[model samples]
Target: MGLSLSRMMAVLTKEFTQLVRDRLTYAMIIGIPIVQLLLFGYAINTDPKHLPTAVLVQDQGQFSRSILGSLQNSEYFRIVHVARSPAEMDKLIERGAVQFAITIPGDFTRRVVRRDKPQILVEADASDPAATGSAVAALSSLPIEGLKHDLKGPLASAAPGPQPFEVVIQRRYNPENITSYNIVPGLVATILTMTLVMMTSLAMTRETERGTMETLLSTPLRPIEVMVGKLTPFVVVGIIQAALIISMARILFGVPMAGGWAALILGLFLFIVGSLALGFLVSTVARNQLQAMQMSFFYFLPSILLSGFLFPFRGMPEWAQWLGTILPVTHMLRVVRGAMLKGVGLAEAAPSLGALALFVVIVAGLAVKQYRTTLD
Candidate 1:
């Protein structure tokens, strides 16, 4: 049946009135794009420089000092950690604490003076090779050039092989430099983040909008019960989401699930709980479904930016990196990547798992408190 012009206009006017009345919706419509613009414009940097580096200096030599100085000057490397021993440095790299490690042999100065090709071993955690590629490349040219400055006169004339020292770059983990190996596992974290947070954020708000919240509250249900009841179903949904992503990652992308299945499953459980708890907390703040959706986006933006998913985590400034640590997704990425890519066990992914568990506890506590307050 053809609708009448007057009736269609009336329906259109009603929708417009509802839209205007919903201030949260209006703000989201206008504010999200502006926020995205600022975030992407200022915060996004693909070619990240000044990656965190660790140094194990056994040589107290002018050549070693010159090499380190040149690395700092290149603006590609920042030596944040000075390890006492090579073993300590390996632990640092294993924990994803440092991107690059420079080991200056005890005889570096003597070798350089004698015109011997002393090898300066540089071990790079090549899990995210793109982040370390430029910095590693800089090491190749910067050290040789810096050595020339110090090795002037007869030393310069006697310098062997055009360069003073050899740089042995050991690209550990994902040596083939496959981009998918880094990205596919990260996709598991990213997809779960967007879906779980957005979906659960709407849970309480939907009940409120439909006027079922009061009815539910009036029942003999405690705040914890209410929160759990709302979240339990979503937990199953999260498991389904994880299953799909993991399966596709294996079959379609050929990303290996090399980590212990127990560790991976446990990490996924903690991460999903934390994400769902975050959504519940968001629901407590938002008065309606629109506000819930908007709040979810607000959290999603920073999570994606600072979580080492899109850009390198070490590439961010100290303040930004600190901010990322507070987000659950940050630890989730670490857990998933460490497990999937490095074949790490529960002990290896312990810190990230602990962080996720902590997040879940804190957020769930807040949600329960807010739920009771709302009930009163």
Candidate 2:
């Protein structure tokens, strides 16, 4: 009675058998740790390199060429676009097309020879400060390294005293580099993603567990009708959550609402629908509430990490970036940040909007198909 080894073994064996039977939970237990290890070890990067840059070199001189070459050799800046004018370069930065823009005035060479200390303008899209920090630091040594070969015995005097040219960095779209400015907008996407998906999945799974789903499914309602009916309330909750977050972002964090409200509203609607649809899909896959929650967490992990919410999106490896791109949260973050910080309009936010719209369609379709299968 005091110590029964046989009884203990029987209970332990039963639990083990149950654990093995629940494949989803088993996978979560084993798979979560390995995924975390791989992502933290290989996918995440703090000091990102090869950032996309645009160049507008008005000066065709030797010194200009030297500076450009130095930038490329630094391995920090990858010159992806050659802009013809200032307007074009600005457009590139605004669209998030380029992280950095280098503009060397036409008189760059003549002024260096005259010791006029010509200024080279470096404009950066500073929305996510962490992404640009290392690259900006690398620019400080460029003046000396860029002009070293061109500055010979005759020009050694000009190079020895101070830098021949000044590198002036213009940090756009969060000039002060406020962390909250970046974090707040991203929170809009993150919060909705976590709550709406988790809630919807749990709600649907609850219906099944309580045996209410059987009664509901017996009705004349179509699969799409059921999905839409279940998801509509959550959509309203998501909207309210978004509004509260945006208001707090403006009032508490002092984040700018620089872009048009139309774009923000459009993005929010698309993202909310997409997130709810994804939740519906998760619910369809899960056999119970616990499994629904586990699946939700699995989805949440990648959405938060790879979506550039916690880290710089471009800072991740190419493969990680590709994975991030598939998540609806990635595009939602872009749309939210673009509208709040960068003043992007519908045209500029088109790509992200389109991506969200597509995600909604695909996920919703899968959810309906899964529900229909259950009906059979």
Candidate 3:
């Protein structure tokens, strides 16, 4: 029981030899961080370009024509559809086909001629607040000179142009158009998906790689209990991370939590469960921790890129937007951002919550089934 320096030295020397013999540790220390840096650099673009748009020209007058022409001329809008009616335009916007829609009323030109306010309705999907800023700015500024020209045409004798009706501008979601207000909501989901999935999967992979999983299975401990225990810590960690991010957003980034805190937390719980379950599936199939990490990153890439986290959901190519629907992170992000920035209730967040619930049920069932069969 007395101090034994020789024995301690021998144990230290043996551990060092084992560590040096295993090349995997050194590769891990050098390789993984490098790959993360490269991926982040390429994929994390904030200033999205070439956003698609749809035009709803209910009015065929000169004022409507000029406004539509401005949008068409801009590099931001691709103008995929020139909708004949409001109903046609609404369908495209809801299903995610278009990033913007300019609705020209029947009185657009007449109002300007009659010296009344000329109205142009621009419905911008402010889901990705950062990218939508440029579009909103351009659209708001569109009717300015055109309306002035129309107003001046009627008043030839007057020295200056009459004041055309004030364009009552309404920017959806963030009326102030704050980027952090929108970005922070989505950040919670992105951070949770990466951390929750990677953390749980790494531990599961660690058990199998280190050969402790076999010993646990041989004992009386049930698979469900082991899994529940494994997940409990991560659930706590995920929630804590969510709180930290939300607080940082408020203090550092000026993001407001406009929605009910309870709703955000509940939705986040479902999101975390779904994400961790997906990681469990990855862990079940992967042969080692490295492979698990690689597989997790594959999932992460599509989720972040196509989930409307890094890119505007409305702005992506049609095929990419369709692919985004397959991931639960995309739906949950809508719920979180909707609640936080839009001040939406459970009614508005219901669809996203339902999607997360379905994804969780499916992934959790598959993971548990695969784990059981693998043990047998």
Candidate 4:
């Protein structure tokens, strides 16, 4: 008649025994967050290197030789292949094999000395804007510098010789090159997605594995109420994670918020909801937490690659960029970072906000529906 406090201790002990057997789950719950953060932070750099360039040397003259010499010596371009004509250059770039192709006009030698300047045509694949930039900077500097040296011609001028045309370049978007401006905002999205999804998926799956889900089903609580209650703690975690991330950006990276805080928070909330709902949907379908984690990772890879985090959005092919536009992370990244760093208004982030909101409602509703009714 009285299985009192002493007897209840036996049941709690049995629960502890079951938890201890699943050490892999316990380790993953504790370890993956710290490990992935360190790895992604240090190892994942979008900046590309060793750009492939094809060279076509038309003239064997000293000036042409010097230009070619400079190109060979520079770290930016690796001359993996060569072309003899403009047609060849076109073929090389068109094949999607080369990042840049430099052509020396057949009359380069004669033109340089005779006209006091010869121009070389430098064609680059703008497909990868970031990689192309470094290559262009190196190649462009060589010709002008070579001409200046030749123009001086052992004569020291009292006045600085004809100041060649200069470009007062003004950089846009990310002017300062501070890692934070680009990295911090993207980290907000990435971290929120990773943490909220994994956390929600694991917790729900745990309830099912323990056979407590049937007990919950017996209660009067509706499916929607149960999902909402399960989601509440993770939402709090998402907000706390956001605050810590922003603080890290401010104190460690010196990133400033130039835009309104309300817009940033609103966009972030939608994005988090979408990602978390995706996890909840996965939990409903997966038989175990491992499958749920694997599913999240499956989505994670493409999100990182196509989300414009490690690559320029404009650099991707039209089809690829169109595919990238569908990811909620992509829209959220643009909204939060562009607004916070660039001081962009909601009018500017309107499209991104709209996309994120749509994703949120669709994912959340689907998750609720799937959790309520079995997919079978």
Best by lDDT: 2
- Model 4 lDDT per residue over 1-376, tens place: 9669978998999888876776655555556676466435543444545667788887777767666666666766668887877777766664445766777777876655455344576676552345456656655567456445544553224213443212122233444445556777788888887888877887778878888887888788876788778787777788889889988887888777776576688887888778778888888876687867866775676677667777755455556668779988888777767666656666666778899999988888888899778522
- C-alpha RMSD of each candidate structure in angstroms: 3.4, 0.9, 7.2, 11.0
Which regions in candidate 3 have their CA more than 4 angstroms from the true location? 1-109, 121-127, 144-168, 220-222
Which candidate do you rate higher for lDDT, 1 or 3? 1
lDDT of 3 by residue, 37-150 (tens): 754555445555567778777778776776656566666677788898888776565444566776777776666665566666777666566767776666555555544444
Name every residue pair that clashes in candidate 4: none
Worst 10 residues of 3 by lDDT: 153-162
**Candidate 1: C-alpha RMSD after superposition:** 3.4
Give the Cα error of residue 72 in candidate 4, in Å.
25
CA shift of 138, model 1, Å? 1.4
Per TM-score, the best of the predicted structures is 2
Q: Encode model 2's per-residue lDDT on 1-376: one tens digit a residue.
A: 4989999999999999999999999999999999899999998888989999999999998889999999999999999999999999988898898999999999988998888889999999999999999999999999878878879887886563658989999999989999999999999999999999999999999999999999998899999999888889999999999999999999999999996688889999999998999889998899999999999999999999899988989899999999999999999999999999989999888999999999988988899999999899
Off by over 4 Å in 2: none
Please estimate how well model 1 matches the true structure, expressed as its whole-model Cα lDDT: 0.84
- Stretches > 4 Å off in candidate 1: 1-21, 258-263, 285-288, 345-348
Q: Give the per-residue lDDT of model 1 (tens digit) for 1-376.
A: 7869999999999999999988878887888798778657766666778878999999988888988898888988889999998889887887788888989999999888897878988898888877887787777696567686788788888888578888999987777777888888888788888998889889778988888888998999998988888889999999998889888888998887766576788989988888888888888778988789888988788888888887888776667779889988888888787777777778777888888888888989999998889888
